[model samples]
Target: MAVEGGMKCVKYVLFCFNFISLFCGLALIAVGVVVQVSMHKTFRIMDVNASAGPIILIVVGLLTFFVAFFGCCGAWKENHCMVATFSFFLSLVVIAEIVAVVLGYIYRDKVKTMIDNNLSDMITNYKVGSAELRETLDKLQETWKCCGAQNSSDWKDYGSDGQSVPDSCCLEVKPGCGNGTMTDTAKVHQRGCSDVMSIFLKRDAQWVIIAAIVVAVLQLLGIVFACLLMRAIRGGYEVM
Candidate 1:
């Protein structure tokens, strides 16, 4: 009886919701991988825990994927046990997603602060830093097309030849191109990499937050539908 009438509609909705959730899980995993790569590329010069945020997202995404599989099977089979289990697991996924979002937000702020405080050191370390570190900074500047920690002048103290910027900061690249051009706006990038990259970092973080929040909100409907379907099945309604 419970599966008849509107209960039938509820059952189908539950199935559709889980279908969407399967894709949602895949999306979360993809986003996490992208963000993880960006974090390492952008903040590798600093001491940020670049893996933690993305790892959390990926784990939750895997959980969501498997739970949605349970949901789809249960809803289709009219099985009470699987439906109940699906609801419980979906509830946990929602919570885990929220937590992942909060952690991402916190990590974003911490990275921003770390960049501000450590940019000087990063610039100073260019000559002394390991090959990997120098390459990362060079790529950072070249990709962002920005100069020093704060501006071109920030390189005035760099290397033995003070008042020179890296060739990576040149408006037009050539050997020793940044020599004696610390504040030369026409020759080297004038903006700071910290300021330039921060904009992109913030934008990425916002997308991650929005994605997680949207998925969490949407899954609530699935949870409710699963519960109703479970109820219908447990009542011995013989849901078709």
Candidate 2:
């Protein structure tokens, strides 16, 4: 009787843990969708290559959902084999998360240089680019409150007749703000796009890293619960 009662307790506990894992999986997918949409909207016009991080997240999310489902079924049916399988898959997920965190850290370190070079090229070709490209650059400058890729002086190199900066750099919207001599710091932003964008990228990467860590912790918990339930089932509980 005591053994049966203990197994029941284990089953319920495992069920609850797997239920939480189901929601965590859904949340990961939602995060992936949000990241994909934001990245596509922000960089589509700049012709920048999209990162595969979001897609990987979505794939992991789906895997997590299925694994959790198997866990729940295993616990409910008191099936040792199914519970073992769940633990195995959950371990794989933990491994994948570790890899993702390492890759994310590396990418975060390298992204600043990539952004600087891309922004420089975009700024240099802004005048002759398509209207969509121009609009994208204007929005980026306005959003970040920055001027050229490095500094306002970067505009001088590409400027015709010493007027290269776009009006988007203006402190206030007004005519001829981008024109005339580039020396008037009062009218335009002093900070460069690279500085602003580097901060933004770092913040984004930090959030991803944090999320990956949280998910890994949750997976670890789920594995613990699944393993415990497997032991309970092996103790001779009838399969439901």
Candidate 3:
């Protein structure tokens, strides 16, 4: 009689597990699909480095869907064999999730390192270019200090051919100089550059955070469902 009573409880737990798993799995799949769609362009054009997390989420979502389906079907059938099989599968999935979480953490560190490296390079280049500009400005200041009072007489002696001037001398060009290094320099200093980079970096960080949270939640659910399914299997065996 006690065995029968326990079997009834196990059956109930299995049913609850199946229902919860189904809902969670479908929700995760939906979230993955949404994230994938929204981040497609960013991964394709702006930042390839951050793309892996979403893709992993998609795979996990699909796997969860199937796992939940199998669990639900096995529970509904009240078949000990089927329940045992899926329970084993769920255990394996939990292991895989653990491994994936570890890898995701490692990859997160790598992403941070890559971002740091890129930022360092940008700062280095910007400083070098700025120093060059500063040097030119300083030279022009010195020249003006010595030549200002003398006016055009001093200018005439120096000749208009800028070639005669030191490379450190500043020349005023037509407003629209041919787009060359000057344009590249402008791009580095553009207000938009920092904002764009910040947005992209933030996106990457967001994806990482999402992946971590999703994995944690799924792992917890998997463990709970697996235990429920195991109990159901034991109950079915008792019924036999």
Top-scoring candidate (lDDT): 1
TM-scores for all predictions? 0.89, 0.86, 0.53
Which 10 successive residues of model 2 have the least lDDT summed?
A: 41-50
Worst 10 residues of 1 by lDDT: 43-52
Error of 3 at 7 (Å): 2.7
Write candidate 2's Cα lDDT for 83-198 as tens digits.
99999999998998899799878777676677777787887788888887788878888888888888878888555676657888888857677786466788888798888877
Model 1 accuracy (lDDT, Cα): 0.81
Compared with the true structure, all predictions reach lDDT values of: 0.81, 0.78, 0.50
The model with the greater TM-score, 1 or 2, is 1
lDDT at residue 37 of model 2 (Cα atoms): 81
1-240, model 1: which lDDT tens digit per residue?
Answer: 434578889988989988888997898799888878876767564546645667777887788899999999999998888888999988987887788788777777666666766777877777888888778788888888988777888887775678788898998878898998877778999998878877776897898689768877888988888888887787788776
Candidate 3: lDDT over CA atoms?
0.50
Error of 3 at 152 (Å): 38
Tens-digit per-residue lDDT, 62-181, candidate 3: 776676677777667766566666667667767776676567556654554554444333323433556644343324323332111112121222224421222222233233331232
